[model samples]
Target: MDLSKYLGLFVSEGGEHAEQMARELLQLEGAAVAPEAIDSIFRHAHSIKGMAASMEFSEITELAHAAESLVGALRPPRAGSVPRATVDALMAAAERIAVLIRERGRGQQGEGKDLTLLLRGRAADPWSEPVAEAIPLKVEPAVSLRDRLRTVRVRGETLDELLDVAGELLLETSRLRELARQAREPLRAALDESVDRMHSRLRTLHQRVVAARLTPLSVLTDQLPRHLRDIAHQLGREVELSVAGAEVEVDRAIVDEIADALLHLLRNCIDHGIEPPAEREAAGKPRAGRLRVEARRERERLILEVADDGRGFDTKKLRAGAVRRGLLSIAAAEELSDQESLMLACLPGLSTSDRVTEISGRGVGMDAVKNAIEGLGGTLAIESTPLEGTRFVLRLPLNVALIQVLLAEVEREVIALPISKVLAAIEIPSGHGRTFEFQGDEAPVYSLGSLLEWKEIAAGSAAGRPVLVVDGGGKPVGLAVDRLVGQHEALLQPLAGPLGQFPGLSAVTLLGSGRPVFVLDVPRLLEA
Candidate 1:
């Protein structure tokens, strides 16, 4: 039998089991040894070992066997509570297993390292003695034939192709509808009805396909506790990670793009935000610092927050750092509010750390995190109070592939604005169009014609011109357009090659009539 066919299955199942084991080990490190947790760990290790052995992956099999032995020793009721030393050893073994699995998946064999010494050193204790057999007894040779999952994994590229075809169909349907509008009465009615039905069905199908590509944020976040545990241990600090809204689902593409940003934020929380246990205690706070990561969906956007209850941003230090680093003049730095001074942390190569450390102090990570979030059509903001805590809030689009846009004409060109950012569109009176009362505050309004430097279609009269009230970085701004072309379900195709560098525009889309329109980056446009 050609066992190569099972490669994908083995890697997928084995990877999942490894991740599960790592999470359980982190839990075991904190809580007293539960029979159930140990049993769960044993089963995962056994499964990986069997799968690896069947595939003739000797290194993986050996490592898994070692981990399995350590876990098995704890299974017996006579075995006392697990030691922190044992947990550390298993975590190391699990991390190595994860690395090897990824390497093998990429068709590269890992360089084997003898982990037996490490495993035996931790596993040998009063609870159990090391097995003296030179060669350990093997369990079942064949892999487990379990059918638990009802779903199959599809490659992202395949899904993208499906979406592209759907987009083309929608465009063609719209063209047919336009042609139907020009037909003779009786035939036109029939064609119009049919085209409308097709359009509705296509829209539904497109939505379903897009939803299928969404995975819960938990998929990326569940493994973070293990990382935090390792980092906290290394830094000699006690910190608790509490995650909420892990169940929130986002586009797989968005998840992939923000994974690194999320990691960096978590690292910063540990390294910079959370103080050491001794310091926390000295400050009359709990010995263990708390870090919270929460994700929630609001309207068409996903909001993620990473917060730490520790020593908050010291604005004075930040302002001094900014001035010293030449990011801001001493006079300007002194003039900044505490909030503005705190924002300086996002400036590149600016750190408030007294000395360099392995994890941070090179002053590189936070700015990259902000850039990564913004690159995904998102905005990142910071909030902190001295001696209280710090929170980083990221607002991101729910899906990058498809978006609801308000189509409008500017400078005789059709432009798209994300509907999520538009609060309302209203017709403004001629003279009153210069400014609008928003939340009891006067906000200056600018017409697209004036902003784009195009000759106004109705230069003298603005009696019936549409003004879009938009949330511009938390403040309302009015944007006037020549005409409100109405709402559209647009397939956002990212600009490629040289055009990708263009500012004030994130993507372009083709209307059902085959007319291409640029999708404006409303925030960037407002700033400009």
Candidate 2:
């Protein structure tokens, strides 16, 4: 068998196993080292070494061999169990070996760092000694982190396929429900019960498909620490990057797009916001700068924020640059908020730097970040304080492949509201007082039927508009629609030609009945 074809799988599996071993070792460190932990580490390293040897990759084999030896030394029956220092050193060695293997798999040369030094350095904990009553191993079977780590690494195409299947199931369920509704007799009505069960099962399947597409942001943050190290070295600066809420899960597709966007944002902070150590010290700031990235789920959207403890935007200097470039009127520039003014840096062809530098300020790529993010149906907001720092927050929908939509009818056409954005559905009396009490204040409810000029509502053929109470930037408003149809899991179908340019619509989907339904763009509608 051609081993090279399996190289990706080998690397991915090896990396996953190494990570699991490291986590288990970390948990066992300082505490009584469990035999299982040592065995686990040894097995992982040994397997990697064997795999590399079989593939005839000498560098990988060597690194794995070193790690395996260190781990094997810790395995029991040698008059003592592993010591904390030994375990730690072994984990570090394993990490280095894992990186080398990964780089070798990518056809890059291994770092060839010596692992013998690491092992010898940790040979003596000096405190580890046999005790009269040895620490008891828990009797209950322990769960291995390796066992917990799933074997299958799902691909993007598989997620898309599952989404498509879920949508198809939804369509079938809807069709069956429609048939049951149109049934005429008691015998037919009895058959409808089976259809209802099928519908419920389809919903469950749809939920699973959506869940499978989600991945925690931590997966993407894995490389940021190394990246920070490289950038800090390049600039002769010291940076400590902290990450929070890495466990916050988002749709994998959104995570990928956000990763690319956030990379640019982080580079901007390192390249421009943070001054070198000497410069920072001269300016009375701390020698080491701090950059923090965090992710959290807010309502139906995922929020990603990257903040740096560095020099804030200089509005006066920005205004001067704008004037020099003739991009903004002096009067307009004076009125901009610091946050708003700082956002000008994101504008196409606008850079505060007078000269293009290698680090940043080429003036060509800033707008790409904004455009790429906005293209993903996300909003980017910038926050800055004079001496505090600057933060760029991005809000993205959880998933778009298969969406739970609040199905509603406009004219005779059904529409979908990404269940994420829909705050609530309520019935409002037609033409009642335009203002209603909300949050102790009067708020005006707009009619989607009227805005889109849905013929059924305009012609007064349908009942009172169905008002959907929506939270738009903490301000709640009601959107009136023709009538509420049941919710559906639909595959998002983008609009075609000029109709796609409609300010209030994001995507469209066809119901099982083959009827076209427009998915409401909540953000765009709120903007309008």
Top lDDT model: 1
| Segments in model 1 whose C-alpha atoms lie over 4 Å from true places | 1-157, 172-193, 435-444, 451-461, 471-477, 494-505, 512-516, 523-528
Q: RMSD of each candidate?
A: 19.5, 17.8
- Candidate 1's residue-wise lDDT over 469-526, tens digit each? 8887777787788888888877777777666566678888888778889898878776
Model 2 error, position 414 (Å): 4.8
For residues 1-528, what per-residue lDDT tens digits would candidate 2 score against the true structure? Answer: 788886875676666666656755655544455444567668887888888788777776776777777666564524343555566556666677678768867878675445545454334332354344232222334456785675578778998888778868777877777777778889577878677656656665776677788888888898889877887787677988899989877778788877777878887787767878887888888888899998876444678889998887676777777777898898988888776677787777777655676655555556778866766777788887776678888887777656678888766767788875666776655545464556476666776767654221332322266777776765777777778888877777667678666877888887767787888887777777
Lowest summed lDDT window (length 10), candidate 2? 454-463
Steric clash pairs (candidate 1): none
Clashes of 2: 0
Query: Model 1, residue 195: displacement in angstroms?
Result: 3.5
All candidates' lDDT scores?
0.79, 0.71
TM-score: model 2 vs. ground truth:
0.63
